[model samples]
Target: MLGLLQRCLVRQGQRSLHSGRPALMAVSSDSGVGTTQNLSESDIHQDIDKRVKKSKVVVFMKGTKEQPQCGFSNAVVQIFRMHGVDDFDTVNVLQNEGIRQGIKTYSKWPTIPQVFLDGEFIGGCDIMIQMHRSGELGETLRKAGIESQISDPPAAKDTTEETTPSTSSTNVKS
Candidate 1:
């Protein structure tokens, strides 16, 4: 049943990509039956927008936060962990091919493990890594009204004592 859904989703995604039209999603109803739903391109964008805004931090990756499938996805998970952000939402792209493609179109980004902070696109793994290294990620979280658990390093003390000026100087000719 899952395989059938995947195939349908893949075909739908392909058609949407090639024909430049909306795709039909196979939605499973409460009666344990599948039904087709007409999902427009704008609908997908709206859905993505809602999802990104649903949390302060939302990660659309290849797997869940607990078990990321791709290395890039794992890196994103670890970066969030380093910031002590444990309550963020995670959407596993591998579970739904339509979402996997839809997100790319929505964000205009060609990669997975996308990060959204307060409904704003923070970027992918490489961008996240750069932001993390530059302490921008923490600042961004702070701006988003989420405090990062990782504290800043203490300021360096001025330990250098005053030195006397040299009494003699040497001159060289070239």
Candidate 2:
């Protein structure tokens, strides 16, 4: 009997997971209310978990690359810059109503500006700076086969400068 009750409760929670409503221990008074009425914590957690594991480098911040909503987020960007990162992905948790809360649960880090490298949770802004200072960041990049901008100059700029001829002319017609 106890097992049957537990299964029923689980089903109810799953049904309400995506409805944007809090999961209740007791059944709602209205049986007409459907799962669409509310979303459970499990739904939010699943959303965050899928994103964290989806990319090689993922930054869960307050804002996107163009605009960071918090000082901590900006600091994370700067640290990545120092390490010469040419490509990375950012998730603006502030924009997502669910992600802002979900990410904390997913990472169990209790903070925004979380950084992940090669699908592994690295840490937040402070950790990033510390790793860069210790030179571990560069080593990690190499191990992941991720080329850093610090190690290699911009190829396009270098090639252009090399191919372009000098505009100034020293030769004079007599």
Tell me, by lDDT, which candidate is best: 1
- Residue 79 of model 1, lDDT score: 76
TM-score of each: 0.66, 0.60
Q: After best superposition, candidate 1 residue 30: deviation in angstroms?
A: 16
lDDT per residue (tens digit) for residues 1-174 in model 1: 224434544654465578743333233222111111246667666777778887778898766777565567777777777788888888776656666788999999999989998888999988987877667788888888888886654455665643656567779687
**How many clashes in candidate 1?**
0
TM-score of 1: 0.66
Clashing residue pairs found in predicted model 1: none
Error of 1 at 60 (Å): 0.7
Minimal lDDT window, size 10, model 2: 24-33
Q: RMSD to native for every prediction?
A: 12.1, 18.5
Q: For candidate 2, write residues 70-96 as lDDT tens digits.
A: 556766776666666747788776445
Supply the global lDDT for candidate 1: 0.71
Q: Which stretches of candidate 2 lie over 4 Å from their true place?
A: 1-39, 151-174
